[model samples]
Target chain A: MNKTIIEIVDSLEVSKVYAELSDPQSGGICVFVGTVREVTQGETVVALEFETYRNMALKEMEKIALEAVEKWQLNKVVIRHAIGAKKVEDPVVVVGASAPHRDACFEACRYLIDTLKERVPIWKKEIFKNKTVWVSAHP
Target chain B: MEILLFGIAKDIVGKSKIQFAAGEGQPTSVKELRQTLESAYPDLGRLSSMAVAVNSEYVRDELILKPGDEIAIIPPVSGG
Candidate 1:
């Protein structure tokens, strides 16, 4: 059996994510953190604003975690996403995976983040010096 | 029925939810609802892509909107 933790909050603490994925039987724990960048295509970004259809996002993340555990045979999986405004370098997401060995852990970690990007219902917008725009959407 | 909005869609709609009369007095399919929205808010038509969710589940545009069904407009996702 595997454990899955999914959260959507205003901020994320990597240590907390690491703590959640810690397992005595696992030799490797892979963690991924995504942060707001200061620039995009040469434009300075002041901040990032993230939003979600909370219920749907949660359901989708949970499904991904459960499926990753089955496919990768992982021991544990954790995903945390931050909402609201975030400054440059502020962590926006933390995904962690632990397995009995390193291979499954790394693959599951990558799968979780990649699948989340393709399926999760969260959205982010870059707040530039004078205006805000979605990462990619109606301009 | 109320159509909920999020992200850029919320900004364009100017609110989180709005009462929508998709088919007046009859059942409205998801595609028809989208057409009505596009007509009422042309800005929505500008979206690169969008989907409608029923009861927290994203379904095809052909799914009919029923009374009391929870509807949401999902824009392109960019979360990492």
Candidate 2:
């Protein structure tokens, strides 16, 4: 069976996601990690607080997975996002896709992250040295 | 009368669920609800630039809200 959406936002283990996609039938598996940066918009960010409408966020994520399955002919997919407060260099999001070929895996993984950034309602608050600013939803 | 709140809206409202009364067939646009929310909780008025989404779709201020619609007020995001 093909995997689609796996959503979480706490300290996620990379090995666990890799293990889940290690299938004998799949020829390629691609993974992407989005980390919290120390600076944003030229400001020194101290930390970030991420929040989401949990239930709806999951539903939207699932929809993305289904779309990938149909569009990429993939064997499986996984997406995890961390919620709450996070510091710099922390893994905030992870996405993995497995397909029969490397090209499909790469394409699907990129599409998944890009689409999630545009569609997901998850928001982030940047706590800078001087003040706090809110930014647009990103994956 | 029920609107699903999310993100900062859920935090500011101090609850995830809320009920509002709308006149018969008089759509509750995001703009109208913002005014009502400000009256109910003046503190939220400070966040004047927040956006609204109806039924998981981001919409303009004039979009009419229906009963049982999941309404979300989203602030700007700051994620990587």
Candidate 3:
């Protein structure tokens, strides 16, 4: 197995991902951090709440990291997510990759975040002033 | 068998876990489990999409259920 860090915590540290993905063999490092935005569409968001199926989410995250490492020849990778309530401007998720070249790191970083959103068993709820809505739960 | 619910599914079911008593006619497959849940809780049926996971991995509806298997309902994911 490669050097991959996958964690789901109550708080997310934006700086930890960069340090975790540092590798002497890597020439480029790319990261994507998702935060709780204050607005969505026309609604003003107060906060965001996240929940996860812990065991499954971790397994899926590890699978995604391993796949990225193999596909992009990455030297190091990290995927971390925050659960519970997050205030606006708080970091919610972070994904990053370090690779031998810029192209690989960039591509893998995109893949890491995108695929994690699609496959991982994590859910986010949007808390507006008047209503709290579960993201993508309905048509 | 017991089915664990998470995300919107948990909200719809109003519980974190659903236990199917053996005498109540247990679902023998993933497809049947989905059907039973949808009928029991119509809200779950109205979701945009959902998936089933067995043993911490996504599985097709045709997968057969076995004793002591870990099953969960995976609603649409929005994590980034």
Q: Pick the candidate with the highest DockQ.
A: 3
- Residues B1-80, candidate 3, lDDT per residue (tens digit)? 78999988998889999999875579999999999999999998899998999999999999999999999999999886
**True-vs-predicted CA distance for residue A67, candidate 1, Å:** 1.2
What level of docking quality does candidate 3 show? high
Tens digit per residue, CA lDDT, model 1, B3-79: 89998889888999988554564338898878878888999999989888899888997797778988899988899
Q: TM-score, chain B only, every model?
A: 0.88, 0.72, 0.95
B24: Cα error in model 3, Å: 4.5
Q: TM-score of chain A, model 2?
A: 0.92
Clashing residue pairs found in predicted model 2? A8-A81, A9-A81, A9-A82, A9-A83, A124-B78, A135-B76, A135-B77
Question: Residue B42 in model 2: shift from native, Å?
Answer: 12
TM-score leader: 3
lDDT of 2 by residue, A1-139 (tens): 5476567666766668878777787999999989888877677889988878776677667888889989998888998888889899888888889999999999999988887776666877778888765564222
The collision pairs in model 3 are none
What is the C-alpha local distance difference test score of each model? 0.88, 0.75, 0.92
Separately for all candidates shown, the number of backbone clashes (residues 3 or more apart, or on different chains) is 0, 7, 0
**A-chain TM-score in candidate 3?**
0.97
Model 3 chain A: lowest-lDDT 10 consecutive positions: A11-20
Tell me the DockQ of each model, to 2 decimals: 0.74, 0.35, 0.89
